[model samples]
Target chain A: MSKRNASESTLAHDTWAVEARGLVKQFGDNRAVDGVDLTVRAGTIYGVLGPNGAGKTTTIRMLATLLRPDAGWARIFGYDVVKEPQIVRQLIGVTGQYASVDESLSATENLIIFSRLLGLGRAEAKRKAAELLEEFGLTEAAKRPLKNFSGGMRRRLDLAASLIAQPPLIFLDEPTTGLDPRTRAQMWDTIRRLVKTGSTVLLTTQYLDEADQLADRIAVIDRGRVVAEGTVDELKLSVGTSSLQLRVQSPTDMDRARQMVDQVLGVKSVVSPEAGKITASMANADQVTDLLIRLREARIHLAEMSVQKPSLDEVFLTITVHGVKERESAAVEDEHELEVTRV
Target chain B: MSNVSITPEIRRSLKNHTSLSQSVRNSFTMAYRGLLKIRRTPEQLFDVTFQPIIFTLMFTYIFGGAVSGNVYNYLPIIIPGNLVQTVITTSIVTGVQLREDMDKGVFDRFKSLPIARIAPLAGALLADTVRYTIATVLTFAMGYIMGYRPNGGFGHVVLAGILVIVCSWAVSWIFAFFGVIARTASSVQGISMLILFPLTFLSNAYVPVDTMPKWLQWFVHANPISHLVSAVRDMVNTSAFGGSDLVISLVGAAIIVALFAPLTVRAYMRRT
Candidate 1:
């Protein structure tokens, strides 16, 4: 941790670090970001998670004042993104998916340029550049051109460049996309340190684990709209029930295991696959003991049996796939009922 | 949702949000950063330093005898012509650097920055002026070394140098626009040269356009490069100041900046 703080002189005190309503962005004929509504608190990590081509980048661009939304409005740190962009610019710093620093310039020079652009005096810019180089552990390479820095070093320098003036709100769009695991961890630690100092961050990433680790709240966007938004545990609960899997020693005993599971659950629909595995959805967690007893009485030698909950990947698949199917069938039923009514 | 476009509200509101002066200031800052990049790499100096030396020597030796009957006789003509050629050739760096920056994700980074959207594009053009000036001075110095005497002396030489620098700076916007829109850096260079070479070569640069075929003469006479070269020749070779060439050069510069500046800025702003 750099122990570097955004002093009153460097910080822009503002409320509501970011806010957006019905924001939309399009590229050519494709709606890259559909209508999105988001509100991030003053000093928290608001993580936007989505699959590739899910409009995360487009939404971020609109919020950062990089792209103009086709519809609706957005504001950052209490300033309307379209109407008060200069004030918005002064209050925020952005670290993009790729390193944006000039490779031809030394790391120190890169930071100094940013510092000057941020309106720092020449000496102040120099001092701030040195401070950033030290904080990012790039002091030794400060005088060397960024082209010679390794990937991880360049990314760190890129991040350091963004923090030169220590704006109150910072936008990081896939900041760790191409970094290695170790480098990614280092970058995450840096971000954690930033939050500790009360800087708000709007992070867009495809990595679910990253959201789980860092985000105070997560918004999962798909097809340009937020499909779900909640804490991790809350999202996991949306699937409705946990699943239990039992592996019997012999494939031939699968039918017997299925019968036992059906008897214990009082549901004739329990499934037993040819691989000697029995899986059942358990709405009541208290049935574990009865299920075990039934398995023992069936004389099925078990290799392994465990209770497990759905993961984020499973939750995502269920929502996108099953939810869509459920909607389609519901529409079909409504059409059928409408025909019946007309008849 | 599929048939999408930037709404009129966004366009109208962008003007309200982003001011022209602020954009120009942002553009200048970006250009200053580019100037810092040139300071760091310095290896980009090969063209400015080496080209002036080679072209000055080669043209003076190769064309001097056939045209002026002696190398010394051609000094006054060859020096100014080579200076114009070298500086203009150096303008190719505008597109090349822009392409390189775009390739290296610099523009992607710029898109996220909240500054004026045109800053990066404008800054890139600003930074290459340093390179053009270096070529201008070096070519003149090399000419001085080759025993070329300008009838216009030091003051006129300085004016001519400033003139070439300004013209090249304006010319660079054309290349900068190419850099922004071109798919690759090599292609920007190729395309810029495809437009530059014939204009410089066929003009009254190395020889009088009057001695050629009527068709060739007309093309040469109307070429902007001819105005620029004639402007330089009047200043350096004859110790005279003419308003016509200066007007042509300034008008040409104004037209290029007018046409490309807004187009480039608009395209650049829409990129994100």
Candidate 2:
């Protein structure tokens, strides 16, 4: 009890905090995460950026050893996630996209249970629970059951629970999703503080700006694959600063819509035939006004349109050149029957 | 929404050389958590507290005169019967609570920890003994209030109580397996009651077997619930410490646990 395992105590600086290769996980007929690869240097924040149902949580689950990969492999601090999980468990902490603390227990009790489970002495566990609750600004509600806490308070307690053991590598899965801006900013500060103190952090988020604010590197995942990976500047330059997606009212107008998009944006665009839509990368989002005006003048009668900040459905179309070609030539499988609910 | 199902993680691939002491400590900690839940809610004890008293009083009066010609004469037969029935029904709560506890997010946190895999399950099963004891004590007290006296003496009465509580704990493992495997908490309740109702009602727990038609009597006498009830009667009424029924009851409880504990753990481990 007085000594620690050598492997658990030693964390070499040169080791990558996270290394994953061609990882895959499938649920039913859905390959939620297909062939994702990532590498993060120690002492840096890595962001897995994706939109809803983009498999961000699934990939994080596999990395955290909560879900087994269908294929490929991952290692945390050079320990194989599958083969050396007990070692990996000792080396990492995980905070899920949802609050993981016991809802029926008070904030203090939840933290104490988590601490005791991690082998802390009973008195030490109690002290740590009180310390963390106060630090998270939850001291006032420490005695109240978690069911009484608000969303932000619950999320704070969730992170506080993860920090008890302070494992070398921490997984924060969308730590700020659904939070108010002030709370989100506070979470960001807390995350930055963790990395500053020598812990390597990996977070998943849907906001590109969040990645820009926190991550040293960002992986843009779409439909179960990493479409782009680099610093924020490099990814933005390659995927186009912003992109646009326009779905027409009818499928027959898709070809003509693509032509108008190419003429207005002055860039080639890809046609997603079944969706009756066209997607194009733009130098700036301000250029969207010109394209919309031109389509109106040409009487394209668009059903729906929007310029997006490289959302999950748009990232792969623009980042992967071969993916563009494949979609452009693929046969139209289904006609769009989208009810034009909006005028 | 982070709805993670049980995914097989190479079957504890992150193997730590967990000493028996650490496993025991982990189990005690988890059990403590279970006890905290009981204390916090307190209402969770309502079934065990109220159901036994209701059954003991209801069954003694309702069937007492019809079965044995008077209420006092029926007290001896019905006390043990209601004891077995009340405590066994309480065992089903173990499975129901376990199912309700496994919200994927909380379960994910549990799985990510390095403690012994069985701690949470074992702790939940152990904490349920509190419920069993409550039901056992209440049933006996209700019998005492209704004028039933045990010639087997206070020691054997206590022995009878321990035997039922122990058997209920063993029976709970069967429900614990259902908890891990069922898709919903309500389904666990439905399936547990489906299995328990017939087993309890059709046995000698509530009725004399000879009065039943011959076809039903065959199944009722062979029912394991009957063996448990008979064992309790032997201990309380006759002070027969080592009857064949007692051996059968003990062995039956052992077999139930041995068969269901691993089966439950296996189903829980299938994180696909």
Candidate 3:
């Protein structure tokens, strides 16, 4: 028995968990989720973050076996998503972006129905339903119709409903999209616990801070393609090394600070706003002291000087918006270059 | 013992996720859940209950005197015709409900679950059979209360009810395909009625087909609803059974099921 258990544990650990390559979904000429490659290792929260229409939901749906890829192959727990979809389904639970519990049915009954559908026996299904209701903090309202529940409670019920069978992988599509900040944090803790219990999760959300807070690794998708991906630190590094901020007494002092700072840092940019605050970025963290010393030596009176780590929002905007502009201009130049190449 | 218990569970779940069986099981489970929902909310029963009563009374009284010279005489023609029409028309709600469900993102949720791809569509199509049966029973009961007796006896009436329910179920599959493929519930219901109304109304429902003009008469004679109404009329009014009409009705039902089942499944597969 021990030998068999060891073999089973080894088999589970060695698998790539969920792997997809060259995924392309085309609706006519418009590519919705294009040329996406994703690998989510076992027992980690992998987040796909992007703005609306960035194909985050599309990518998650394909991974969950809802949509077939036009030009790629995908496998869940070493089983092909299309060819072995049932196996994939058994291993995973999915909570959609929308609340999907039957509105007329009571929360307890809804959970019981899904439990039975998951192949639990009648008594066992009820037991699982009760367990989930308690776990989701809805035991008091379990018998009430879901139509009467608040939005946050309904979302919790939806998540609980998905987990009745205790699936190994879960796909949560913007699970906390409309929740209050407190509820969102509580939900994040719940997700963290799921990961602790050996469940892998693939989540998609528009909130950059949510990805920064919850994801072990984040994949930033923009305009149907993955523009950047890594741990939070790695992604921040991709944008810049450090953030430099200087607060001046007046607007004139802010400009003087920028002028002195731009020369000292050798950075080509300056952002001294009308509010008498100057915040610029350096190429590296080591340049911050030099920046402050130059400002002090120039006799630029500073109220505040600080060096901070680059934020996820900064990384997101720098990578996504900048990438789009660069692509647009590159396309224009390519068109012109094409004419020149023809000439 | 542990090996015996755990391996099969894992294996069964894995098999359940990938194979076509997942789709079938998913569909059956969803249909079952829908039935449970109907149990919880009985308000949906209004259509099943009220439509049969109103239609039966209105058609039997309003058109009875002019068409057949008396209400009793009208019993033979209109009851059987109404029986066929009401049951078939009740099948339209299946498509409408499907449209509403899709609009509600029920199908969207189903797409992510890794269950059978066809389960949501198939389950919905199956659940409407209960609705079809309810309409069948209520219309027949209304017919009996109105002094329209089925000379074929209780056994034959039961057979006729089953026949209509099964055929309507087959017809609902066509509408179900439209529900999945159409943009809205109203359109699905509209498209289904646009095809059903002319076939039903122009047949032997209210007026005799022989009274119509030549071009119209030719269509009424060839209509599949005409054959079903004839077969039903022969069974209920005169206790007469064996004929080409009965054969034609069965053939029509089989053909509707055969043609639409695959098409609906194909359309449903392409939805995601």
C-alpha DockQ of every model:
0.22, 0.21, 0.29
Q: Considering only N, C-alpha and C atoms within 3 Å, which residue pairs clash in candidate 3?
A: A85-B17, A85-B18, A86-B17, A86-B18, A87-B17, A87-B18, B22-B116, B23-B116
The segments of candidate 3 whose C-alpha lies over 4 angstroms from its true place after superposition are A1-14, A248-302, A329-343, B1-13, B16-28, B241-243
Using TM-score as the measure, which candidate wins?
3
Q: Can you list the residue pairs that collide in candidate 2?
A: A85-B14, A86-B14, B6-B271, B6-B272, B7-B271, B8-B271
TM-score of each: 0.82, 0.82, 0.86
Candidate lDDT (C-alpha), each: 0.78, 0.82, 0.78
Winner on DockQ (1 vs 3): 3
For every candidate structure, what is the RMSD over all alpha carbons to the true structure, in angstroms? 8.8, 8.5, 6.1
Docking class of predicted structure 3: acceptable
DockQ of 2: 0.21
Considering just chain B, what TM-score does every model have? 0.90, 0.92, 0.88
Model 3 complex DockQ against the native: 0.29
State the lDDT of candidate 1 residue by residue for A1-343, as single tens digits: 1221335521442456777889988778877778899988777888998776778888877877777889999877556788766556656777777777777778887887777766577898899888878888899988887768988898888878777656667788888887899999998998888877767888988787888788888888876888888877788888656788888788877777777777777655355455556788777878878878777776778899788887776666665555455557564444433432332
- Identify the runs in model 1 with alpha carbons over 4 angstroms from their true place: A1-16, A246-277, A286-305, A323-343, B1-29, B116-118, B215-219
Models ranked on TM-score: 3, 1, 2
